[model samples]
Target: HPLFPLLALLFEKCELATQSSECPSTESFNLDIQAFVQHQDRERKPFFTEDHEVNDLMIKAIQVLRIHMLELEKVQELCKDFCNRYITCLKGKMQSENLLRSDYGGYDSDDSSSGAGSAAGLPGIPPPGMPGGRHSVPPGLIGGPPVPPYYGHPGPGPHHLS
Candidate 1:
């Protein structure tokens, strides 16, 4: 009995690296992929395995694949939603700018009253006291001058009638 114990101890040198261990981080991802493949191969050997074992393995594989597909779908949906929101916001800004420009002095090419552009009805950026620029009639009133501070100021009121 003492010799048998001594013989077992001599042959029992354990290895730190074995099939059972915590998976490494993504930096060592190739090792994990190889392990997954090896695990699959080993689990499939012993051809006469019970039907229940085969069923269990198949179910596990299906679950992994399903999870991956669901994650990909979520990413796609997020991207689509972001794109739609971005486009809508851009259109709103552009429409507001067009309304502001059409009101300020750049109107249709049919008015034959003033050629100086400013002489027609374009507002000279009226003083701060006037909100609507021309007696509260509102800018771009078909004959009123264009509103002033055209560059950065938010026009009084909504500016967009549409």
Candidate 2:
């Protein structure tokens, strides 16, 4: 609604700049923004809000766009806000979905194997290099070879004192 006009204007300005070789003048930018608002009003179309999550996201987006248009006068803050908020929402949705699936997927809570496993399955832990999928040290003198007893000054065995 109110914010779409601003966002559409910004988009149109961006579009015009990309279409033309020369940098878009301020007048043209402003004109495009006006045209965008006019176009939306003429179409009488509502903002995209089929899903509740999408609707909420769009509201947040509009707020960010409003900041860019009115307060900060730049899109960097809007972009940052969009990315952070959207990612957090997505992560929240994913966690919620996982919880729902775990609750409904008939997971056997009594089974010990569900939680019993080596952390090697986790990400970033390099898989075992040797067989049986377990870590093994390279072949070396790990537990071999006893040092011979040293006689006096590297001479042979001790001789009888005559």
Candidate 3:
């Protein structure tokens, strides 16, 4: 639940970038349309026109198409870059969450240890009940003497407290 806002923001940014990149610039579109219309108009003209004029019209049309093609390629590149960044962001978030869980003694749901000292497997650490481990006995109590249970009297009997 806490990650909702961050994920929402990320998605929003991705959507905005995609929309902006996918939509061709209005000015560029208008220019392309104008060039195409002029080319068509030139073709409809009288056949008596000079050969050089027809060649110039053909060249202009080719140039306009090339420009449109380049713009499409640029938009495609932007989309690819955006997708890569989004995937990286998601990976970073997942790694951070795992680190937080480990720090707080939370084990992965798939782990078989059931929240025991999973750190025991790591280097420079000891296992449970071993020396310097989480469940290890203090040095002073290690094999020193046997502790006797007190019955509140020398002989074993139910004694009343006065």
Candidate 4:
């Protein structure tokens, strides 16, 4: 569990940020990263395996974290960004697994639906006015309308856009 410390730090920071509705400074995060790096160097063991898909997702997550650290340096926002990215990653992973299962004729309807629901529900989206606060938009959607589930889709119901 070489990554345990880093993951714990991320969860703790994200919880605090969500609870307080404020981003914390990046000082502690930086320190934790440095510590993690030093530990990895000392251990001199391979951290990543040959699982390319999982490896790619991990790389993407790290890149997203690094970008936020450099640009925002706000723990709260960083956590939000990271969490959103993470949800995307989970969705991708689930989709891939479903594809594999389908190919093998082992697809499980229960698993796929539950996986999708879990990923979707994890964010517990904030309301519109809470943008950049508890209800902040994902970074890519900043300055844009709040992205409701049906944002771009036309519907047949009363909620349909004109």
Candidate 5:
């Protein structure tokens, strides 16, 4: 899963947040809709300021690719909403990394800080064949049940066009 690296970063962020008095994990983190919506609203203001145009185009492209039913006006509104949530999530993530770096003085030399940068900077790709490689197993496969292998199957994965 390409998002494995991203998920790892989020897990790390959750660990960091557990240390912050302001970010105590309530049952709300799982079941509180009003608080989540309020948090989203609070985070909407500065999230898309840097790349609004490019962000809009990317949103359109994703909508097109996913075959979402797109009414022009509604899609535009939804795009704005989606981008706000996306940017808010990203900001939270970036903030977590900053906190970790400032508090812990960054990772030790042997760890993959460089890899983290590369993975976060490049969205759908990871360093090839690494443990969290984009093409590796799904991120949530921590010991529960055996996950069946499915990558190199006979027919065609998403890469095949014809």
Candidate 6:
């Protein structure tokens, strides 16, 4: 009976709370509460309309969630596109290898002696003087005389390897 004003005030406050994009100012809060309370009958009014407040919040929240969900879906689609492109590129490279192998009289790709260092048949630039092992033992594999280990101690004996 006497609580009508109180219920209206609460309803007003909640309604105002939903209107502002940010927190309601103290004035706004008071005004809202007052507005809701005004709607209550003079003698008595039921609790502030829970249905209205809930409906408003639910709608706003759903909109925000939908926007976010769409953004995530877009990102997912882009990622899928990227993955597809990468797989296509890989497949193309593999196809190129297959075509090359077919042309090479069924040579297995592991036939390193036939082409591994040949960069798919492009002219290889020889490094300066020694000119790509055309002279003397290859850099890392100098097999001539047994040179002293002057470089430094050969570290502790190898562990566990046969």
CA-lDDT, candidates in order: 0.46, 0.52, 0.53, 0.58, 0.47, 0.49
Error of 6 at 87 (Å): 1.4
Per-candidate clashes, comma-separated: 5, 0, 0, 1, 0, 9
TM-score of each: 0.32, 0.24, 0.33, 0.35, 0.26, 0.36
Q: How many clashes does the backbone of model 2 have? A: 0
Candidate 6 residue lDDT tens string, 1-162: 333444444445445444543333445444544665576546366643567765566445434543443444465567768999999999999998789867644442233353323323333522223336344342334555443344584422334244
For model 4, residues 76-134, the per-residue Cα lDDT tens digits are 56688999999999999999887766664453223333233222232343323353344
Instruction: List candidate 2 stretches off by more than 4 Å.
Output: 1-37, 69-162
**lDDT comparison, 5 vs 6, better candidate:** 6
lDDT (Cα, tens digit) per residue for candidate 2, span 21-139 = 34445555556656756776798855555577767775676455444434333344566678899999999999986785565442323223333322323323333543433455433
User: Per-candidate RMSD vs. true structure?
Assistant: 17.1, 21.2, 21.1, 23.7, 26.1, 16.0
* Candidate 5 lDDT (Cα, 0 to 1): 0.47
- Arrange candidates by TM-score, descending: 6, 4, 3, 1, 5, 2
lDDT string for model 3 (107-145, tens) is: 423233443334423435555665677678743345655
Worst 10 residues of 6 by lDDT: 114-123
Regions more than 4 Å wrong, model 1: 1-58, 106-162
lDDT of 1 by residue, 1-162 (tens): 212222232222111112223322323333433554576578664322356665566545444544443444465567768999999999999998688667654543323342322323453433323553344454555565556656797664456565
Off by over 4 Å in 5: 1-70, 108-162
lDDT value for model 3:
0.53
